[model samples]
Target: MSGRGRKIVWGLVLAFISFYAFLEHDVRGRFAARQSVEPAVIVPNKALAPVMAMGFHNLWADFSLLNAQVFFANPEYRGRIEKGMIFREMIELATTLDPSYKVAYFFGHFALSSYWNNWGVRQANEILKLGWKNNFDDYRFPQYIGFNYYLNSENKNEIVKWFRIALRYPEAPRRLIWTIDRMLRGADTTNHIHAESMCAMCEDAKEKEQKRYFCERCETYTALIALNDLRLAYLRDKGRPIGSLGDLTAAGYIDKIPVCPNGCNWLFTADGAITSSSLAESSTDVRGVP
Candidate 1:
């Protein structure tokens, strides 16, 4: 409208046009650079993932698994991780995020089916094996492995081995309450199984505090196992049972005693066994909270 005002407006318009041009040029450069590069997974390493999560490891694991699920569900990306990175194997990043995550192993079949690819089947089994190893009582883990075998192999023994593991629990075909009841009755490895159950609860928990709580319960059972190992080692070396729990620390079997998450004391049985004082026949009660 006025001479000075008009000049200022014109100057601003020129500057805006120059900035747009620079931005367009930068975009083109990046597009060209990535044109030859294959898309890659943005996941972090399994061991270092806990550090990245900073205590919300289960949440991160859920995010990573969901990311992979969405990616694979895409019709364009289905059966392959990416076009450019054809040879790159998709590591199960979710498991790395929370190795104790129970369902991530079961979901391996999403890729394991013949529709995904041959490699998908193999990779799925690899993921399932981790689950099976950590969760021996879970029928689904071994059952999934058996399904994978049916997909790729005619090995009946391998198939039976997994199926037998699955059938060990009569409650496998029933509701979860039944399974939990049977486990509580007298399963020899009840503590380990309960620890896995806690991990499963952590996997499905909606809140951060709840997830962390279940995970801590799982860790208590893990500590029980470690402390027992120390007890056995002390017995072997000293040629007698430990008079007390402190002998393991004094003998350098462990740097110190593991604290129970329930704020209870760790017990040293007369037979040189360790257990949490909170639960009955054993101390590895992973089901309760403070």
Candidate 2:
């Protein structure tokens, strides 16, 4: 209301308008954009936002990598591992934060499927969903989906569709990709049948062996099928209350239990070779079985 007060107010209003204009000016547009904020831009090499959001320790995954190295170096304790659920949870939490962490995706799949059994299926599916959400155009997600169907859900159609999508990727492994392409080009074919065909499609004996390995190695339902057959053998021969691999073998059904690669141990072969994914060897009772 007073002269001096009114002048001060007018001066402040002008300064405020100038600041707004400065912010909106073309010269400032680039700096205002997200790309200009280096930290905000999603860097492929770094832990992406989702991975950061999960509150998982990067050190844990790193430790897992180290443990894998130890495993490769001295694979003496293949049978003993505990805390499988925890390992899976960490992997799920990590990939949930960074879906593109391919190593985590793959190792997570292996840790869960091979060691923890189908306990990893839900985590694998979660990873697949995250991949789909973040990078749908990437065929890797669909390939994972197909893998899950083949392993967990046993949905042949869904498996075929996803395999087809994976085959479209430029970086896909040609032999496997072409095998999937051929299978998807057909209908009503089971995975076992598809796997046999894939083996036959191989031109070289070594390549055929590799294909056979893929078919038997966690990628197929071999583990689950073997476990089922072993269970049935127990039920049929010795009844459900049976105990020990020796018992199964004595019953003439021991061959039903599947075999892992050499150096893999039989920590618990009473019912089957139930490996502990997250448990250390010191924690398991590996004394009784021969």
Writing each residue's lDDT as its tens digit, candidate 2 over 87-106 gives: 55455544554555667766
Residue 89 of candidate 2: its Cα lDDT?
44
lDDT of each: 0.58, 0.49
TM-score of each: 0.44, 0.36
Q: Pairing residues by index, what is the TM-score of model 2?
A: 0.36
Q: Per-residue lDDT tens digits of candidate 1, residues 1-290?
A: 99999999788666654543342234444555468743443445566666755556676567666655665565666655452122112235567766677767666565555445656677677778887787766778876776676566544345545644554554456343333323332334336655555556556545555556656656776787777777678778878876666676778887776778767667644344566664445444332222
State model 2's lDDT.
0.49
On TM-score, the candidate that comes out on top is: 1
CA lDDT for candidate 1: 0.58
Error of 2 at 128 (Å): 3.1
